[model samples]
Each structure stands twice: as structure tokens, then as C-alpha cells.
Target: MTGMEPLAPLATAGRRIETAIIGGGQAGLAEAYWLRRAGRECVVFEARKRVGDQWRERYDSLRLFTPAWADGLPGMTFPAPRSSWPTAREVADYLEGYADMIGGSLWAGVRVDSVEMLGDGSFVISTTSGQWHAQNVVVATGSDAAPKIPEVASQLDPGIRQLHSSQYRNPAQLLPGPVLVVGASQSGADLALEAAQAGHETWLSGRHPGELPVNERIAGPFFWFAQNYVLTLKTPIGQKLRPVIRHGGSPLIRTKRADLDRAGVHRTPARTTASIDGRPTLDDGTVLDVANVLWCTGYLPSYAFIHPAVIGPDGYPTETQGVAADVPGLFYLGLVFQRGFYSHLLGGVGRDAKFIAQLISERALSRNTVAA
Candidate 1:
């Protein structure tokens, strides 16, 4: 009725389980679902105060790129119409309902501080609430854990308002003047279009990742083809294209080039290459004097809380399709390209989670037999 209903707290001190899933978003919830079917005891630790706060915390103008029918986790289908493009609030509500329906082991308001592997091939999770010893640890914290803003931001004048896309809630959150949105990713394009629509002189800068044939609106037979075929990494061509898309960023799926043109949003070079006299400078030597700047440059994967040995020098966990190699009981979920192209998407996380659940179950069976 008011704020989110707080999750009943668990006794955090010395809790032990078969698995510990971090970050109670789609990835963690999906893991919990299949683990329950396997009768594996697991717990989810969410940093947010509420169940669906992750999606709810994003920008105000956000909507799911995928159709509602394709956005569900393992067993729970999203309740909206199949063709509908759900709002961020709808997604948030759906996640909350999903959590409630599953009734799995979850601890909200608990921030995972550190995860360490013991010599006995087990993991110890340290959190704001308490400690947990888990036989297996699944890092489902997702790709958006840390916002990546360039160091050049410090060079800008203090008079020009600047914030990462994560911090942006709406156009009203920005100062009244020309708005500069850096990064041509979906978030950047959508925000730029929104700013322009709101009467702000908006400039969008970044390398175009290209646009999808269909968006949330005016989707037809092409929508099904794009969703079920082209975007999936299971195909040979899709596999070959994964690296390019991953490094370049996802193509504009929701906001199209025509939308930007209609909104009168100006385009610039791929990045803010430099700063001149407290103004934003692009790669092509274009200097923009804007009052507000939104950095949609994307997020850095933050696994700092995890031990260095668990992660590669590239800042990713040494995992093959969610199962870590060097660490006996360490696993990862919700990462970009974890297994397939859709791995990070809401619809795709469940498949990866199910696979990981099978691995966890096999290991458990082997251990029990040996002990017997």
C-alpha cells in the first residue's frame, strides 16, 4: 500500500546452505527457481531494500525492449499481453509478483560485501546483514553493477551539470539548457530522444550500434523473426557476430533513427573525446557548450568483492557458461554473453540458471555418494 513490503529478515549469523545466490534480480530468482525443483537449499541476497527495486530504480522513460511474452523467468510468464511492451513499472511489478509466487529463500536489504573460497572447497559470503557459508556461490549481480564514467568528466566546469544515466530519473532532473547525451547505446538514444521531446536542445553522440527493424511500437511479423532468430547466439552467424555487438553495444532496439529525427535530436561523433574550457568536445573536433550532460557510456562489471583468484585479468569470472573453472564451488549468472547472446536478458537468464542448477545437482549427488 505504501512503500515496498520489507522482506522478513533472516538470522544472518553463520547461516549455511548448499548454494548462495547474490543479487536478487532476474538471474538470482531464476537460479532459485530451478534449485527449488532440484531440492537444493539456496538463499538469495539482494542489496536493494525491496524485491523489484533494481528495475524500478532505472530512468523514468524506460520500457522493455523485448515483448512481454518473452520476458518471463523459468516457470513464471509475464502477465501482460503477449505483444505488449511493458513499462519499467510493469516489469518491476512483475518481478515482485514473481518473487512472491516462488516464495523462495531470499534476504532483501542485505548487501554482499565479500565472497571468499575456503580451502575445503566452500564459499563464505560476508554481507551487511551477516555471514553465510555456502557450498556453491552464484554471482548474479549482473553487468550494470558499476556505472563507467570517463575521467574526462572531472575536467569539465562545475557549472555544467553532469550525471551517469543510472542517476538520471527524468528530464526534470537536469538543468534547463541544451542537453548532451554521450553514448549511442539504447539508453543514450532513448534519453536523447526524451530530452529533445521535452524541448531541450539535445545532442546525441556515440557510434551507432545500428537499429532493429522493429521496435516496441509498430511491431509485426518482423518482431517475431528478430526476437526468435537474429538476436540469438545459437545461430552460426549470431555466434560470429557476438563479439562485435558485445564490444560495440547492442543495436538500438526500442528507439529508432527515425524517432530521433522526428524529435529533432542532433547527432555527433561517437564520444566526448576531450574537454575544452569546461565544454564537451567530440572526436571530430566539435565543441558543445551544454548545460547538462548524460553519460550513457555503460557500466563496468564490478566483482571487487569477490576474491581476485576467482576473476580473470579481464575483470570477468573464469567461468564457462556460468560454472567457474578454477574455483570448485564458484559460479556466475546474469553476465553478458554468459552462454548465448540472450544470456543477460530476462528471458535468457533462466536457461543459463537451469544449466547451472544441473551442474550443482550433479556435484551434490557425487559428494553424497562419496560420503556414504
Candidate 2:
């Protein structure tokens, strides 16, 4: 479909398409842009009511860790000062604008239920609205979809207000009293600081992932260059650091330990491992009596919609770079450390998208030639 064409109606049966990109976020949109440039027809399926709802749904005070200059996707620059950090709303607005500029077929408010590969290698994508039959399917749904909360959360007092970081909007949602923010990554630190600044006694649980070696503003260009070009799977250090980054989580980008301390946020080195008498218990045997608990524990990869044949034990697709080797035309995008540390970031996803798009275009051409 052309950029000028209206969004195709949802067919309850199955609408055939050349390529179905299973997301409308930065990753999916980038793939669509590259495919369009390659003269390939494609459609983007976005579960949200609108493009960029993912970012908009984050905490109200959320802003990109990277400066605006490093947050734009392919074909468009983020409309903000280069050195400025764009807020969540601004990123969302930019995505919406980028989608409009791309003008590819995008189905909003459509949730894909499942993706099954046929005997012939084509895909059957079942969705809330309808089904789509496509020769190629790019799973660009991103890494952070499902919020990860520990099973011990159920033991917390029912009176205690609990919320995962994803569900938290602002301090207003928190109950009046001391708040315990679990997990000391960027989100945890940010929320803990916010809670403390909001006049609540806040305790930040779990050891931090560490902070940047230098202030990002002072080393913006160098940091960008390292993350984008130097720190890659191709390098020995990048390979060694991959597991630490993937499992331990990225280092604090915006939130620093000093910042948390400055906000009067109590920092705990122990993790919130259990609950005692309806209260949070730390691994160090300290029990925290708080009115609210904010779980900033991060997210798990959710690819349950994908078929078992395509998904691995890690809940991720078995793919190299972005191309699925087992399933010829199946691809994945925006995976953490997919190609490098920046693979899932806005500025970095375009490279993986471009690579996958080229492969898909080449395969399409080969298929057409064979048929002819």
C-alpha cells in the first residue's frame, strides 16, 4: 500500500499483505520506512489506540536518558534542542509525527493475539480485530512489555498500595505515608527520588546498577559514539559486557546515587526479597513498614503471541541480528542487545530495521523471480 492510501479496513477473515510488522513503535516504524524505501508493501500493527502510546503511558515525569539528538528514528530528527532531554509526551508526539511522515499502512488499536507459521512458511497473524496473511512478519513489539513483579508481592498487606513502575504515573497515585521503591535501577532511583521530594519518607531497595562514568552532558558526543559504534557485539568488551548488561540491567543513565542521596532517599544495598507480617522484608533481614510499594523491577520479554516453534526458552525469538534463521521470513526487532547495546533504542533500532528490511526485500525479489 502507498503512503497516501487510507488505512485498509480490518478483514475478519484474513487480509493478505507482503509484510506485516507486528508493532508501531520506533522499531516497527523504522522497518516500515526501510521497506517502503525498498519499494516493498507493508502494514504496521499497533496494539495501542495510537502510535507512541507505549512511551506516553510511562510515568508523567519520564524523560529520555539520551538527549533529543540521539532519540530520533530513521527519516526524522527529534524536534527538540540537541542537548535537551525530551519528556515522555514529547517522544510520543514525535513518534506520532514520524508515523504520519512515513505514511505507511498502520492499524491502530489492534492487538495481535497470535502469530502462527504455516506449512508453506507464510504467517497467519490473528488479532483482536482480524487476521492477516503475510509472506514476512517482523516482530518489533519491543523488549519491555510485561512488568516483572516478584511472587512475594502477594504477601504485602492488602492495605498497602502497590504499583509496578509501568503503572505508576506520578506521586499523586501514591498513598500518604512512607513509600518503598524496590529495585535500584534507573526507574527505581527516579521514583524513589520523586517520592522523597514529594515529602514522603522513601526507601530505595536493591543495589544500583551503577552510574555513568561521567556526566552525560559533558560526554554526550563521546558517549553517543561509544554506544552506537564502539560498544557492539563485534567487540570483545561488548561481548563480555552483554551478559552483565542484559541480566544486571543498564547502568543508571539519568539518576545518580548522589541525586538519590540529595533527595533524602534512603538507599538500601539489600533487595526486597520477602514479606514479614504484611510488611516488606529485605535480604539483610530489615523489615520496611511503608504505606506504599513501587516495584521498579523492570520487565520481561513477552512473545507469547509467537508460536513455540519460533520462540526460544528465553521468551525471545531465535534470531541473528534481526533475521529469524529457523523461520525464513520471520524477524525480530528492538530486542535488548539485539545487535549492540543501542539495538532497542530509538536512534539504534533503525539500523537493525534497515538490515531486516533489506533481507526481506531480497527474499521477495528471489521468490518473484522463481515464480516467474
Candidate 3:
């Protein structure tokens, strides 16, 4: 808050900063707030041209399927009743405001190349723009830092006009014909339903019916119970569970059987894998004649900038909460559970950010220094 610059061109080259936040997303912005409140100095490096660019890049029709009550950032709420979940653009605007509140030290569009520990044990974070030195690092780019489109997705017929969920804007932007939506996850089902409702012949392919919501009265405090007691998501055993994680059931906007029927959204059998006679083919050997394909497959977390020595067999930064055994001083927050499952939620990031920020301050800047 004291000494801040808007756009820094490699701060006095080679001058070391105490810490560097490696993202400008929800996690990065949250951490920056805490880092400042704690009287710790740091710089935030964001690869995008502006804050909330990630959300801005999402589909135009996307909304926070999680209720509006869950959309609060550290010190601010969505400002309506708790039920006002924000659209993608609204969230992005909130983040932009957050950046302004934090004094705009976000160096946008500067991508990090590699982060290596020097002989002196400090971190040397090199980027496309320049370099920065920090005693501590927070990798808060979030889970969907990169999209996980399959290699074969590109090999589909050129006439198909394929688009991933990330690139999809609206049905109007799609081809002038029926559309085939692949994957049955929330994105897939929602897109299929939207397409069909927009007067496009839409077919959805998914094996799992996915999870459905419960009546609030009967379910009790399901969210609270799940976060505090259950092992469905971030708990120890659940983390080791399996390749197929339990779905969030249905999103708030339900894509139920009735909804599908009324919307004329057809559900083709699962296992659909290819394009036939220039159309998408279902696993049952049936073909859905269409000119557009929407692949809402999902995203993969990428840690390629991190060297393999610090990575595990799964090719991720092997860390616990914000602590990593192999890589000391390498803390990750706003990840799966620096606090809880809601840690990733807009409202829940403050707790995670505070916790991680406290740890960082203690380890890197505390007057009563405890060895990190």
C-alpha cells in the first residue's frame, strides 16, 4: 500500500522482492490483498492483458452455477441478496475492481518461463518480460490453468466447425445446423440444452446421468456437511479415490429428463466417439447429422514451468496444502485445500488466502522467524 507502481518494467533490474505471486486470478488477487494487509511486499505477475481474463474468456452464456451467495470475494459480496450468482463477465469485473483495490501492481501479459532456485537458495522467476527474485512463491493459477482438449479433437472433419467449451461464445456463433455436444459433464449437458433451446437440433452424449440435487429441507446443511465431514472431495481418502471423481450432480440449472424432453435436447447413448459421413457418430453406430461440435471435455492443471525434480509421478507440484516436501519454500494456496473445498469458491478464497498469507509472512518476513 505504501510504495506501489502501476506497470513496472522489471523493477530496477535484479533488485530482489521479498515474495512474488504468480497469478492474477481469484487466487492471486486474494493472496495479494492478504499479503498487503499483512504488511508484506510482493508483486503479482499475470499472463493476461487484464484481470479476470480467464473468466472473460469463458462461454458468453456461462453463469456461476454455484449460487450468487457463493460469489463473494475477500472483502466484498455480490451486493444483492445471497442468491445473486454472477455471470462470467460480472465476476471478471469484480476481479478488475479487486485489482484497483490492491493498487494495481499486477504486471499483466508477462508469462513466466521458469522458476529456479539459485545457489543462494532464493527463487529466480524468469518471464517473457524480465526477471524477479522472491524468497517465497505462490502458484495460484488455479486448476483450469490450461484446457485439456484431446489431440484427436483437431482431427475431426474440417466442416464440423469444432469448438471447445472454453472457446464457445453463444449458439449464434455456431454453424447453421444441428450441433453435437460431447461429454456429459456440467458443461456438456448445459451446452446441449442451451443449443437445443436456441432452435438448433442438439444431441448430448454422456454415460453418467450425473448427480442430482436434493430437496434442501431433507438434505439439511449439505454443503456444510460435505465440506466439514464428508470425504467426497478434498478429504484424504477421497483424494486417493479414483480416476472418476464423484460429480457435483447437477448444476443449479438442472438438465433433467423433463427439461431435456421439453427443450428437444436428444440424449444419444454414451461412447459416442467419431464423426460419420461428416457428422458425429454415436457409440451405438448411430450418426447425428450436424455441422458443429462442442467439446466440453474439461481442463488439466499444468505445472510444466515447474521442473520434474519437484513434481510427483502425476506430474504435479507435489505439495500438501501449501507445503511441499521436496521443494522447500514452495507453497501453493487457493488450490484444492489450503482451507476447504470452498477454498476454490469466490467467497471461500479469503480464508485460504489468509491462511497461506500468514504462513508466508511467518516464514519469509516474521520478526520472530521460524525456519521454513
- Candidate 1, residues 221-276, lDDT tens digits: the string is 35445544675666776677656655556677778889999999998655798999
TM-score of each model, in listed order: 0.92, 0.94, 0.86
Cand. 3 TM to true fold: 0.86
**Poorest 10 consecutive residues of model 2 by lDDT?**
1-10
After superposing candidate 1 on the true structure, give the runs of residues whose Cα lies further than 4 Å from its correct spot: 1-12, 215-234, 308-310
- Clashing residue pairs for model 3: 68-84, 68-85, 211-249, 211-250
Clashes of 2: 0
Best-matching candidate per lDDT: 2
Question: Which numbered prediction scores highest in TM-score against the true structure?
Answer: 2
TM-score of 1: 0.92
Regions more than 4 Å wrong, model 3: 1-13, 214-253, 275-278, 313-315, 336-339, 365-372
lDDT of 3 by residue, 119-148 (tens): 666789898877788888888877676666
| Residue 239 C-alpha lDDT in model 1 | 70
Question: Best to worst by lDDT, what's the order?
Answer: 2, 1, 3
Off by over 4 Å in 2: 1-13
